[model samples]
Target: MIDQILEEIRRYETIIIHRHVRPDPDALGSQGGLASLIRDNFPGKRVYIVGEETEDLRFLVRMDEIADSAYAGALVIVCDTANQERVSDSRYSCGARIIKIDHHPLVDSYGEPQWVETSASSTSEMITSIYRNHPELVLTGQAARLLFAGIVGDTGRFQFSNVTEETFLSAAELMKKPFDRQKFFDTLYQRKLAVVRLNGYVLQHFTLTDEGVGFIKLPLDLIHSFHLQSSDASTLVNCFSTTEGLKAWVLFSEEEGLIRARIRSKGPEINQLAARYHGGGHPLASGATVYSWDEADGLIADLKVLCSRT
Candidate 1:
């Protein structure tokens, strides 16, 4: 599979990489690492990684390498994105050929020549597997750090149930390069006081089902009253996971502009619940959005019905 992907890589002169919108470190890291690998190995080829704004990952090795103009004939390599609707940029398909390498479950939008492994812990893990067989690709220290960050973030530091032996093996392989493991762990796990307090509020006010699925809905007024920024609510569901006897949890936060929802599960699949709202993700972890708080609440009720059966 790696050889086939590398052969696909060699077929194009220009390659543009993409990932999911509202990218976390893993999404940016895979795109940046792969783009750097291509640029370093295929020195003459033009490689670009395009996506929506990345959080705390703007300082990547080749962050400034993307070109403003579309390539006349390009191979757009999409990573981490599960569904085409969630793709960060719409311009990717303007290319001549499309190759998708994702860890998300197969969705209808991904074209043929798709390489997806739903069992993989993270997209970053898949990227590492791709480069493992292609040692000729110069994986630099900075690029390695970016990849490491992604793998750790997506795996929840190898603590999530999605983690597998391959996940650790790929992470160990990545540690070969001169990456700052300590700083990477700190940046991802460390939280501020406001963030901690925000999480406290969510867990304290959360409602749980008899079957162990938990839900927390925070309105915009309450979010503002706590002075919690969107960054603080980034992983609000993480707090609920620590609640005793929790098999799954969801966080619905109302922002001024949009209604956002995040779902995390350990004992049952919840992606179908997310899919009902025009969103998709891995079975254990998924998310969706609604236009208003009322709609999001209705969706939460719908998810509760599904969880009751699980």
Candidate 2:
């Protein structure tokens, strides 16, 4: 699969890379890291990484504004995204050929020569493996930083169950590069004062069920009251994760008239539940959407039952 993907990369002149929406570090890391790899190895090729930029993560990499014409005869590669619906840009289909590079369980298979490694820690790790296998490919300091950030973000700073020997080996390899690791960690975790305050509020108000299921429902007004955006509120999902008897948790934050569900678990598989609610991701960590407060309650109820069974 790596050989096939490398061959495709060699064939294209213009390449556009994409990832899932609501950009997280892993999504941005893989998309940008792959773009960096291509740009460094194939200097003559034009590479553009496209996606909606998140304010907090913009320090890692910025999106490129290319015209529709740029997608003409381009090779589009989507990173870290499981399904087409979650892909940030609709323009992904405009490419002449498409490839998928992801670490999530296959949800929707859309790309040709798709590479899905569910056991891999992150798409960034998979991207790093590409450089490891192909000696001709160069790993720049910037690429190393991006890939490392992605691995850290998805693995919960290497605290999650996903980390394997390959994950550590990949990290060891990336650390050899000359990027400022301290600055990357500082900048990646620097949160606003308002967001800190909101975390306190979540710790106070989040609901914990007897079934070992915990949840937080942050409506739009409640988020604005904290002087933070919905994205800021979403980060607080893990704030109360250490609570005793907590088997699984979900943070439902209202955004643009819909509730975005960021689901995490300690014991139960939750991605199938996410899939039923217009989302999907790793079993332990996933995302979903709910249209109304009642529907959100339904999701919570479902999660509670799931935890009860576990």
Candidate 3:
């Protein structure tokens, strides 16, 4: 699959990279890392990263805005995204060829050359694996740094269950290039006073089900009270993740008249549950959006049942 991806890259003079909407570190890292790899190995090719700007990741490389004409003969490589609707940009379809490189479970196969390795820790890990297989492809220091950030971010700083021996090996390979790992952590973990206070609010107000499922519902008013973006509020789901006696945790934040949920589990596969509620992701981590609080409560009830079984 990596060979086929390389062949496609060689065939196209313009390469455009994309990721999921509301980009996470893994998404940005993999997209930027791959773009850097392509640019370094094939300097003549035009490589661009296109996506919605993420305020949290503004410290990293900025996204590019390419002209529509550029996609006429471009090769689009999407990273860390499972479905077409989640893609940051629809212009990807304008490309001459498309390659889907992801770690998510297969949903809709949008590209001709699809490489979905669900076992990989992150899409960044998948990109590193490709470089490992094809050593001739130049792995620049910037690319290595971006890929390392992606791997570490998705694996929860090497604490998640998905951290395999291969994950460490790939990380070690990327570490061959000199980058300030400490500085990266400093930037990633840095939080403003507002964020810290918001976390306190979440911890103080979280509810626990009889079956040990922890959850919190943040309405738009509460979100505004904390001056938090819906995405930022959704990240607070992790605040309940490590609580003792809890089998799973979820955060439901109201956005644009709908409730968006971020779900996490210490046991049981919740992605299938998320899929039933209009969202799907990894076994332990997933997301969904619902039309009403009742629907969100239904998801929580289902999670409670799942926790009881475990």
Top candidate when judged by lDDT against the true structure: 2
Rank order (by TM-score, best first): 2, 3, 1
Q: Positional deviation of 233 in candidate 2, in angstroms? A: 1.0
Distance (Å) between predicted and true CA of 194, model 1? 2.6
- At residue 147, candidate 1 shows an lDDT of 80
Cα error of candidate 1 at position 138, Å: 2.4
**Residue pairs with backbone atoms closer than 3 Å in model 1 (clashes):** none
Per-candidate TM-scores read 0.91, 0.98, 0.97
Model 3: per-residue Cα lDDT over 1-310, one tens digit each: 8888888888889999999998888999999999999999998999999989978788767999889998987889999999999999899889888889999989788888889999999999999998999887889888998999999889989999999999999999999988888898899878767778889999899998779899999898888888887777855679767777888989999988789999998878999999999999999999998999999889999998898998
- Rank by lDDT (best first): 2, 3, 1
Clash count list over all predictions: 0, 0, 0
Each prediction's RMSD to truth: 2.2, 1.0, 1.1
Model 1, 1-310: lDDT tens digits are 7787788889888888888788887888888888877887889987887766744555543344355466568888888887787778788778888778788888765754788888888778888887787776688877788787788888888898778999888888889998788877777677667777887788679988776878888777888787876555866678768777777778887777887788888867888878887676888888877778788777767766766777
